[model samples]
Target chain A: MPNSTDTPSNDTPSNDTGSFNPTARSRVKRLHERGKYDEASVFAILDAAFIAHIGYVIDGQPFVTPTAYWRQGQTLYWHGSAASRMLRFQEAGVPACVTVTHLDGLVMARSGFHHSINYRSVMAFGMAKLVADPQEEAAQLDLFVDRLYPGRRATLRPNEPQELKGTTVIAMEIEEASAKTRSGHPKDDEADYALDCWAGVIPIHQVVGRPIADPLLKAGVAFPKGLAGYRDGARFDELLTTNMV
Target chain B: MPNSTDTPSNDTPSNDTGSFNPTARSRVKRLHERGKYDEASVFAILDAAFIAHIGYVIDGQPFVTPTAYWRQGQTLYWHGSAASRMLRFQEAGVPACVTVTHLDGLVMARSGFHHSINYRSVMAFGMAKLVADPQEEAAQLDLFVDRLYPGRRATLRPNEPQELKGTTVIAMEIEEASAKTRSGHPKDDEADYALDCWAGVIPIHQVVGRPIADPLLKAGVAFPKGLAGYRDGARFDELLTTNMV
Candidate 1:
């Protein structure tokens, strides 16, 4: 087995006491060097991705559901039909773990055993409760739309009363959260570096294509200004970072 | 509340006895229509994505960890350091739920309530066990490299005995699996269609950029033929479909 010296120490200093406290549930046990327990790191990963896989238990069985999520400060918000089982269980104050991951690149090493993927991920644990107030729900809905595409909320039709009633919004104050990120090139074995093999990284990017107009759109309707620079081949990372609020 | 008629019946026929039997745990309860139990559908979603969020219950708390996964016939394979807590628990035959999701596009609806995402996902449930046999573990490792990049195993340096010993490979025979997919344009309310708003889709794709060669002493190395066609701006869906093994 390779000695501890072979492993990379990539840990950076924790910001301060103001950063998120590392609870037993939120702590990273494996490869502890990759863990970050700061609000900045956790929120950054959460804000960059719109979808998350929420894990919750019912009847002692674990279920993971992928849904759209948005973060405001330390609170994470998600919604679905009021009758959703996953939402109901979460709203009832059960423990929920929300995870978001972005695959940055494929790390191809000289040996199969050393191959890995570069990724950014966050795991947040908390008890979610229903946003029962209609006014608050409506505001959060607007925020969600605006977060996805800024200023489009003002142009779109407002949510009807019945529409809001049918939807169930849930909010979880991130009680404990941790972010893990891996970047850069593959760290192959020292001796393997001398072997004749192409060892490098293949960058994986999520791109947003051009907006395709609806066939039912009225005549002379132009694309909204909010989506101007988000053209057919815009880099997802650049768009997200530039639009980060 | 959406009545039975308001909800779209997207369910297709479940193949006969040969198809994967959906147990109570694997069934999609919220939107029953979107559930699919056929092997073709489940395998398609599993094969497309290289990463998965594995959910498991530890002391009644759910934890979801995102890791690289590969499927071979009925068995799913994933590896990590032998010291990984998640792998150790899974190797002991604990219940595990592996979920893979691909966000296809953002459904821009006329109203915020109707806004949804087009996605394809698969949730597979099984009991995992460690691959302890050295010979079998070596073969699975090779399969994983080839699965990610075709014919990559032939070009890479062989794994050393120590490397295999340091890694832990786990396999799970999928006992229950289900696939869920949502596609096409937004289904807005009839009255909202008349309103003046650009209602359509913003296609989101995960693309592969040009391979960055490692800055080492290896000069005059040509680009591998296997990775030649995977250009920076290639569409993700087209590439995934064309390269489906």
Candidate 2:
């Protein structure tokens, strides 16, 4: 999601448009047209969701940990206890592959070979950076609150250091990445289209139900105005994307 | 998601129950209570979702690929072009981590430290196995079509050899795995409950909209009975879970 951080992968070959250079490891090999290397496109896909599956290695075994993540400037961050194996291993600046995906539709093609999916996904490669500086950690902790509830940070009680004492946050600079997306109806073979089988797109959407207030909430407290956008039926990605804009 | 693949990790201590014995790498380290090693629990979580992020390594660089996947017996399968880098690299039985997650709610807390998420996630680890035999590949290919569309496989045209000529299917026996879940309302600090800040949960749901038929569908075509289970407003997980049941 590096809009201005478009300093292409070191000395790799980048075209004039400021897109990421397709290195041997980062290029999309299949269905090449669906691959996107531009920062704006990558960032939009990244911002649409706060959840990601982080791929990292411990020994030779690869582990994909699904966690809530946030992006600030060119860096990406996720949190866990200081005791977490992932956080502990990442402190030494291990390579990390952070991937976020939004599956949008069920594509039912006339033939099994043509069936596909519609999704928006961003796969980023980078070295994990542990926020060891106390000041940087404190600042980032505050930014995490604003990720979803933008201006509400000013109104909420501050986190007690002890409350989050053992937690650690890890960051990555999105060194090299690609965004891949597919949408719309399925593409069937020309001959198969004439078959009577039903073939179409069943669009999938993640929507929010009405917010349930805490039972012990104060008498005069109303739903935070900063979070009014999270109404019933509000689309999750739309809320995050709107906040990005 | 294995119900009968009950053999625990070799030489690892396990209680009387048939759940997978947690080894050094497979155990959930943080919130101990949320980790479920029993087969039924793990399979339910895995069956509820059809998409997974696979973590695999090429060189020392890890890559996370989000793909559509299906489960049968104790094995998990996902497909791609035979020439795809991820598939080609995984053909040699690489150590892979497949993770599936359902993010259910956003927990808004009175204090930043108490904020959390309600989610159901499954992580499976095993060596990748390429389905190389032609007959085995053909059978698995047929199973893939039925994963989402159930009995509609009987109504569709068979895939031409050339249609899927270069595609490959990869399988991994889910040797060791764990399911993690969290639900219910926000757990805020006792003193923070008296604060005026809003604290609650915005429940998330993935639902289907009305299915759109292909524009070129024949005039006499009707929605297939096998797919009638998929209707407007059906929950994506519910659809899959029901089929699994």
Each model's TM-score for chain A is 0.92, 0.90
- Identify the runs in model 1 with alpha carbons over 4 angstroms from their true place: A1-17, B1-17, B236-245
Q: Give DockQ for candidates 1 onward, in order.
A: 0.70, 0.71
lDDT of 2 by residue, B1-245 (tens): 01111212212223544576678888987776677787777777888898999999888889999988988878899888887889998898999999999888888878777777888899999998789887788788888888788886778787678656677899999899988877766766567778888877789989888889878877888877767767877788889878532
TM-score of 2: 0.91
Q: Over the full model, what C-alpha lDDT does candidate 2 score relative to the true structure?
A: 0.81
Q: Which regions of candidate 2 are displaced past 4 Å? A: A1-17, B1-17
Candidate 2 lDDT for residue B148: 83
User: Candidate 2 at B130: error in angstroms?
Assistant: 0.7
Report the C-alpha lDDT of model 2 over A1-245, residue by residue, as the tens digit: 00111112111223444566778878886776677888777777888898999999888889999988999867899887888889999988999999999888888878887777778889999999799887788788888888888887788776667646677989999888898877777777678878888887889989888999877777888987767788888889999878532
DockQ of 1: 0.70
Lowest lDDT 10-residue stretch of candidate 2 chain B: B1-10
